[model samples]
Target: MKKGTSPALEVIVATHKMYVMPDDSLYQPLLVGSDFFLNQQKGVTLPKNLILDNTGAHISSKNHNYSELTGLYWLWQNTVKKDTNPDSFYGLVHYRRFLSAKNKKTPLTKTELQNLINLKYEIILPKKRNYYIENLYSHYAHTLHIGPLARTREIIKEKYPNFLPEFDRLKTRRSAHMFNIFIFKKPLFEEYCEFLFGILFALESSLTKEELTRYDGFHARFFGRISELLLDVFLYTKFPDLDKRSDVLELQVLELEPVNWIEKISNFLLAKFFGKKYKKSC
Candidate 1:
């Protein structure tokens, strides 16, 4: 827990782009509810989700299709449609938005900018892989140019008045993006095993171009410290929920299993060092 000896577990930053099932119908409301509460209590609760990290930026729901163009909007607008297919509308609208962004020369609105910055998961465009890479690298470099944490938080809160967990997660995951939903997304812990699985997902192997260079010089240093790094993360996970005994036990089990192997190696090394010390003392 020393200041300088903190674990330097580097996250290789990359985009998590993937084609999602147009499950926008199911997820949209949940997203709304979460955002609403997050914004309503914005001044009181720390807006941890507002921080943009590897998962991407938090998209404002204002310009988002679900609220503006879908049956959900109609429902809110008091124009109920009997055959208004939620799924169909979401897919069509999403496509329209995509094409609009691609073909149009218009400047991106605040909402569009937020989605591009945060909501769009990083995925490699197989055909235009180089372009994707270049664009993402540029984004990573310039992400913080326009705003700092407080300003960024305010901007997103203005968008998703109902839910802001994704934004909250960006803050938590800025330090570590390898973690999937557990770090930033809502965690689903069924039992100890599931909890352990959540932690594992938080571990990622993203390395930016610049980070790769540092690895070359410190291969030995990095390898030597990985065990300690993992252990430290396991320990650090307890905070913000230290009283959760079940979670604490799961973490201990997770750490101890690996610690057994680490302990044996350390014991051998200590024996050798002590023998050498005694010989020198003698």
Candidate 2:
């Protein structure tokens, strides 16, 4: 892959606010992830590719609910530049949650990204995340309305039967790979996005807004939250002993520290104790 011709690894930094970051040697395509209507309204400026995320379900009006995955949808549904770079690996990292260097805090450089690929790593992920004293299901139930968590199970059983056992198995685990963040080879990226969105879209249609809204503002981005848990399920399905076989997660996962710790911690605690019942009005 010649650098002048096309990038080998292209990551879409999903951001929705009015901000700017100039493109550099590393391939960062700024994706404005929101519905077409809101995209026109946000007035954000990116160096390249500020995509209107409405191309899929026109769900940008509900962007508060889908969160960053909405931007990912735009990359999946639109993004012609990927066609020009057929072998380019794709990744979605937030403006806040970049894949950091092992010893330093900066976005992984072109050389680091290429080395991972050269090593035959299948994916790049943040490090193993743990929520002590809570099985995956119990923690989710305490935080979000567990109904949708349950519904996801039924959807898999009814629609994607093959995945049901792993789904069931994953529900019992205490830790997970989270954030809707990942890097994949073009082919695996395609497989992952297709499998992920297919479940989210179908599971959501079975739900009403009443059923979906758990945290008035935050949980509304329910699909993204739910998908975070499923990533572990997806991985375990592929590599049943993944945790044991590779604490490094296939040498495929590149670990990083997430940004915005204050808000992130607050949300986790609030969700844990309150679920949808955290009411200031009370």
Candidate 3:
């Protein structure tokens, strides 16, 4: 591709120069430098003009910004177990699947779970406002062996002889109760939940009266910083042209919060009007 001729294609090509085809074809690899590309067939027909204009609907600069911000936040929050709560984390996934799939006896109830789901999505689905507390442990584990947590847990024991076997043993069970035992040795689990609590208040959502009463300084700092980051991303994306010079920076700050809100409302309405459209052909 000619330099700077196609700004959209050029941007991707520049970032992924090493990942481009050796042929003279104009194609650039998607998910460049990642294992996802390494697994692909080499002789596949790589098309020129493979990338679309960033100005188009799905390919717009705004959507690109939104997806990137959401992804970064997703990475940040995925590290914290409580943030990845099926109730907190995957509520949208379950809600969509259960309502639109063969399963009818879904554990989630709109009446009972809506408040909880709303609170979580508001806080977590934005540019992930919280850091994963377990990243250090995950980093330690991954450094030993590249596999799932259970396998990595075993590797940790063999590699770090001084590491406690009890901690490894607890990690294997994958229980919340198991986590509580070794959690203090790793920082930020309590801090993670405390951040959630502050968000709950900001959203003006109902919480357990006890959650409302608890007070902690570390919790305040953790949440305050995250909330500010989330709000900055939200404001920047929604009004990027507010400062034209650095629209790219503002774009980078975008998140999927607006789209998430639309989807949540749409799903709620779909569930209500369509009588939960499950068993339909995909």
Candidate 4:
């Protein structure tokens, strides 16, 4: 609990499929859709190294709609809330994405993370993903439905009106701390989870069953995408001087898989210039 002390930090890597992970105690590989696999795919064996998100308190059944957030919900209820150690730190990262070092290729080591913690940083986040050609709102509108985002603003107005200002500012920004990746000290972690799920649950209730299920498997996971934007809204509202804050650390992110830049750029251009919505993941 004291400053400079090496506190326990656990970063859960939310994964639905098997993939190689970093060789470090700081990272835990969690199978997000464990419940579905167990119930729906009878007699199937799972990896022993991975933790199942379906255990204890969980929303594992909603993995289809919530994506990696199911693993986050599991961590919130079963780990963060239950742990007796108040100084413990927690984080969420995707199986293929990770917080990286200066070289931007190596995964951050525990010693490096501890050094940051010792420096009194309460939060660690991935570097911003910039869409130089378009703002966040326009990018989402071009690629995904704007209805959910519009309704999210309405929900913020009704429930947390003060956040409306920051939420509206997202329209003017081209870069964002995306992928819903972050590491937080216990207090901030709990506060963030409460604020985040509160808005998401309200948004979920606002949509009808048909509206939620109408999208293809890829697009149906709008809940996760929506939360990506909400992260900024929550941080900005809670910490107005976030950019200047010494307590927050933004590290580079490493992508395990090779990206097809040409295809991704083509899809973005097609979505923005043409009327074609993204049909598949790049």
Candidate 5:
């Protein structure tokens, strides 16, 4: 708990490129596709502060398909679970999206994290993103290929039947804690990884080579996007009273980059009304 010693909360910022990071010990910048980057660009130098996902028991080669999830996998396999401190908290944030404190400009600091812990918060998440016009299923089906998500539901029904109800409930909901972001105390972190990765791995095996390759570049990263929905399934199934739980906290997401709302809305409308799929990131 001492500031000069090990941090109480360690949040890794997943990034594929170099960028300015918060000047706080709590935030660690991670190079998501380090192996691929190094192999493709032999002469380029990487920042020392950015930890490579390729190191020690990692699925670094899958970064292209898994996206930032490779970083999460590396952390799960090689970092947090190995920590000596049982009470330590761990989390993942993107280089551009972070969980903001009350003022909305600052990233959640260790002091604030400690305060949450003191108040009995075992997990912290971003506020749910609402698609007022569409439920989560229709929203995803509108913007992206729904095949993988539908396949995921089948996997849940077969392998985790208890979760099937909540998974189906997603069709009726318009909001979700998305983007695969979260902070959790050690135990919950491990439990989440086990449940999440188990489903993803099964889904991965179920895909045909053709199914995986049929999508264009943006849609190929289905694993990461699909996991975003699974977070809610895991939380809601395990803790049905999640909203009332003193152990869970939801915070605002701070977008470090300016969002192009006009283009984003246009794309959403096109996808929802015109049956067009997204071709690029917004």
Candidate 6:
């Protein structure tokens, strides 16, 4: 593929509970957000792009905790077999969030996205989310589960010992790739999903029933959170020069509109004070 030449890019927007309309700019709009096993949600309209992710041991009903990862799993189990386009790419974005174009505000429209895909970049990632004041450990400790973080490290050490160094180093850093969203070619996407689910499943099996049940909705999404950090670890391992500006492998970084600071702060506070009451009501 030549620079400035467009390619077929298929991005899967993993929306768990929400059924937002798809943007017209992207090549293929594959929505992976169906509720699995049962119909718990009342009024979600399955758009034409819907990928029913409820089957095959899905965690669709637990979207509050698992986030968009449930949709990713659906793609892994069912969608991969049908892909045949050599120029095709696979990506995951959120219904609420997307990888903005150069404007740093809006999601990439068809033309803008075509120009990007033309470059045939190895990876397309959201801008690195930095925690300038404190490193990754302190930031995660303040907002998310400290136990799962520790357990995840141990799991990496025990199962993927070679990745332990990257895992350890990643946690100490001040910033990392957040949101677990990205665009990768077919090969990289498959490899990533395989590795990611491997670690998550192992951790799940390692937990006792009591220990597992202890994590309410607030913390049950441990795997999803850990996967955010692992994205960096995975890139660093594959492309050692990933952080540096180099021509060998181009990693396109994009920014989106600012996140809802007010809502985030409110949720954090509620998690601290109300405890798992948030889960109870939901």
| Best lDDT among the predictions, by candidate number | 5
Could you give candidate 6's per-residue lDDT for residues 151-231 as a string of tens digits?
877888888887778877865788777888887776778888877878877777787877667776657777788788888
Clashing residue pairs, candidate 2?
A: 65-220, 65-221
Those runs of model 4 whose alpha carbons end farther than 4 Å from true positions after fitting are: 1-6, 39-41
Candidates sorted on lDDT, descending: 5, 4, 2, 6, 3, 1
Tens digits of per-residue lDDT for model 1, 67-167: 21222222222211222322111111121122123434432232432343254322111011122222322322232121122333343356433223443
Clashing pairs in 4: none
lDDT per residue (tens digit) for residues 187-225 in model 5: 888889999989988998999999988987799999999
**Worst ten-residue run, lDDT, model 3?**
177-186
How many backbone clashes are present in model 1?
23
Q: Model 2: per-residue lDDT, tens digit, 173-252?
A: 77777767777766667777788889988998998766766457655666777888888777778767766653233212
RMSD list, candidates in order: 23.6, 4.7, 22.0, 2.7, 2.3, 5.1
Off by over 4 Å in 6: 1-8, 25-33, 36-38, 42-45, 55-65, 245-258, 262-282
Give candidate 4's error at residue 62 in angstroms: 0.9
Given candidate 4, what's the lDDT at residue 37? 68
Task: For candidate 6, report its TM-score.
Answer: 0.79
C-alpha lDDT (0 to 100) for residue 225 of candidate 5? 92
Order the numbered candidates by TM-score, best leading: 5, 4, 6, 2, 3, 1
Q: Give the alpha carbon lDDT tens digit for every residue of 1-282 in model 4.
A: 122443568899999877888889889889998877677767877677788888888888889889999999998898777776668889999988899877757888778888888899888999999999899999999998888889999999999998999999889988889999999998889999999999999999999988888898888888999999999999989999998999988999988888899999999999899978887766
How well does each candidate superpose onto the true structure, as a TM-score? 0.17, 0.78, 0.18, 0.94, 0.95, 0.79
TM-score top scorer:
5
Candidate 2 regions exceeding 4 Å error are 1-7, 20-33, 36-49, 54-59, 80-86, 212-215, 244-282
Candidate 1 has an lDDT of 0.24
- Deviation of model 4 at 106, angstroms: 1.9
Q: Over all chains combined, what TM-score does candidate 3 have?
A: 0.18
TM-score of 4: 0.94
TM-score of 1: 0.17
